[model samples]
Target: MSNADEYIRKLSFNFTLSYQMPLLTIGAYQNPIAVAMPAAPLAAAAPALAPGQGDHVFGDVIGTIETALQSIFGGGAGWQTRMQKYNSTLASLWTALTALDLGHGALPPIVNRAGMAEPDEHSHMFGGYSHRFQWQLCELVATGFVAGPTGANIEVRVIGGATKAWRKGVMARFDDLIGHLVDSTALAFYITSPTVIRHAAALVRHSAISLTAAVAYTTGHNGPGKLRVNTVLAQYASLRIAFESILLRLENEGGTRAYNAVDDSWS
Candidate 1:
């Protein structure tokens, strides 16, 4: 098949929204159900596919896979740089996703050795209910380790994009959350993900600071769960997946060359 066809096929594999779920009734129709076929069932989660947009979850890791395969077939100019980002983000995402429980969760019982009153009760997310805001901080694992902005301000807007217009002060809320999270001696997370902790630090300075033409599509997006927002979330997923697919393929093949190539970040 031609390169274009290959890329399309790769991107089309496992598409899914980043995170969202509310029993929203799609305007007035679900794409006019086919008489010849039974209607597709609705997804069991919020951030579900729009009605009739069935289960085809194209993972974002395809670019890496495609490029790695291309190198084997005599193509691919800068696959190494791509590989680092894809792999690290994939790792970072996994770490963040681990704390996936949301809603009315009891804050783990604490025995403060330092003798301090436990902060607010219940282990809940930003709003004390939905996890959508919590999902924004998926990139937190990169702090101190990643070459660019890796704090909470570096969450959803960075992961999703500036295009996603957040609720007023929403971004700042995340920034505060991250600050508290990293600083809190009471709440804690041990970096146990082999996927996240193992990778060497990366330096792709394209976060909230740089805002160059290359990654400058940081406008137009509404907040999560809003109409069309999932599309943008899926796009972010795709970009990271492109890099991860490469790293996974390389590890499987035991190809160690160019493993430490520079991955431009922050700028």
Candidate 2:
């Protein structure tokens, strides 16, 4: 088999294995769905990475993956640099998704007060039964429908209300960003070998699909539920595992050797 064929096979195998591997936990916030209601504004439990920390991590992952692609599909001068530009964009997209997840989790629970109303002794004057009223109040309070003074206060913040629309906008932008990267990569590979472009394109598509699934599972809920939250976390873990697998394969196969080589017509 040719170099490209061998590379593609390795890529496929790694991706399959990675998909089945255990979920990855990034920092303290392993589960994006489990964002706690902050006493202050909604913020991820893990503080933002210090200044260049995020960039360093993004660079390591994106740089390795792009280098591997360069090895398999030769690109014109500066192609790798051009591809690396998307690293920061990808980081931004991740940040946006995390923020949206946290914001959604922090929304106040919707309480229905009518169900909590009880028909008490006073209700007899209104032609109702006292026992029924007394019983209903106890049930509602017990079930958390009625919050006492010391109970957890639920306030609907203005930001919480706008999260739904904000989420839509974030997802839309994610599509655009990923779409651009795919198109750009395809163009780079097309200049070298049209057939090889298919392999590169497929790799990107798989990665994109994983990430899109993560975003979809996250946005699937406007409010938190146990099952939905778990789904979102699982999807994210899958995405991380997939990328890490690719990076590992690239490193083992000496893909970084192509980083300084320029032999295509992508310019």
Candidate 3:
């Protein structure tokens, strides 16, 4: 395999491992609200309480608060469904990306000077002395060409460019999904428990705050919780950087075509 082929394979693998795999666990984390306040079991015997007393008013207030909490946090069913859908989307994306044929074999060599070329100096030196030169002997080997893609090569470039644009769109959707997960998880933590908020406040150095760090602390607070939100976020961060690096490599090095946003076809 050529360098381009190897690089493409490596990038695809990195995206699968770092971006898609970790994303599968984004919804696995236990809802902090559920953990902090579990539903109470029904009492075997009801204590006789006077009407409009302290305990009666207190129970009413608690019941109202629980109802509001349920409304905000949901019952975890819808969240699970959204997660499954995102995971399915990622699986499909992986299949399409892996199936793409971005190999260097399709591209024509930049320098195609095959036939022999007798220099003017040689002709001037030997006017009548006609000397036959081998095709390889007079071949001109050039580094870079100043021409656009043409012929069959254009198809290869179009596929590559389109795939890149499609991947970018998928990435943007992925970001939105992750952001939703993070924000929901963080909100749960903020409302259900003060531990995460206190920890995050302590960690804040200057005026700027890191929500990622807050989520990480919450997930890592009591050992490795059910949700792996921190790992997902970290892996996604690395994946973004790796993706940009892959684009840079394709642009600077020859062989594989770089993304052409102007002429890209999302469909």
Candidate 4:
């Protein structure tokens, strides 16, 4: 073939042009090179109080008990009236401590990171015991008594509630409480019928309790009768100790429940 013929054939083939499929418009970004920004971060879904796997009763039980005992004890007959002021606070402590054992669980605090006010459950509760804890324990202790510091103040919890063991061993110790007239020197040492100090001043101090040493082996003036009150108070102290232990455990257990709830709730 001649050189001019070959050059013309190559030029004809090269004249044809390539075409692009046009930029498919991504949603609303009309420009071909729009480069869509990452969807404006989804408005962050406005944070809500999703329960976390953690303790439901957030406050301290022993701390409150310690607070109460610190305020009372050797303080006189005015003690009960004084403690009445802490009705709400003590009720909270009692509910948190007893709630778990009762299986009611506690009303966990609201955690809405969305900057909202927390919802109140007891907006209109009325009556003597204004708080939930007070109402719950009303039947348990019709006439509340001060717990004496004695013996294993925390051992009864291993077998808790209205079970046979609890009713027989722990609660039975106080079955005689109804008729006994508790005196101003509550938690004070007193003599048993056998003419000897039952929970002598020394024994209470030995048990890490430091009530005012009011009773002597000879006189035992704090109690000439109602010897059962001393026994009941000792049992009550043990029950309190047990409840305190459970409170600490529930703190962690409730948190775990909340976390598991969150995880189970999400994908």
TM-score of each: 0.20, 0.19, 0.21, 0.20
Candidate 4 lDDT tens digits, 64-143: 33332322211245433333332334435554544332111242221112222222111111111122222121111111
RMSD of 1: 22.7
Regions of model 2 farther than 4 Å from truth: 1-227, 259-267
Q: How are the candidates ranked when ordered by TM-score, highest leading?
A: 3, 1, 4, 2
Clashes of 4: 11
* C-alpha RMSD of candidate 2: 28.5
lDDT digits (tens) for residues 1-267 of candidate 2: 555434434533333233312111221211111122112211122221111210100001233233323322323464345334423343343333334221124431111111222212111111111122222111101000112134532111000111234234333432332222211222222223333213211122111122344345335534323243344344344444443343333233321111111121111
lDDT of each: 0.23, 0.26, 0.26, 0.24
* Tens-place lDDT digits, model 1, residues 1-267: 554334323322211121122111121111111112222222121121111211111111222123222232211464334434535554444434333221111322121221222222112221122122222222111111112122211111111111123322234333333222211111111111211211111221111111121122323322222222223333443433443343333344321111111222211
How well does candidate 4 match the true structure in TM-score terms?
A: 0.20
Please provide, for model 3 over 125-222, each residue's C-alpha lDDT reduced to its tens digit, 9 standing for 90 to 100: 11111111111111111011112223111111111121355345434433322222222223233334423222222221111113354455556564
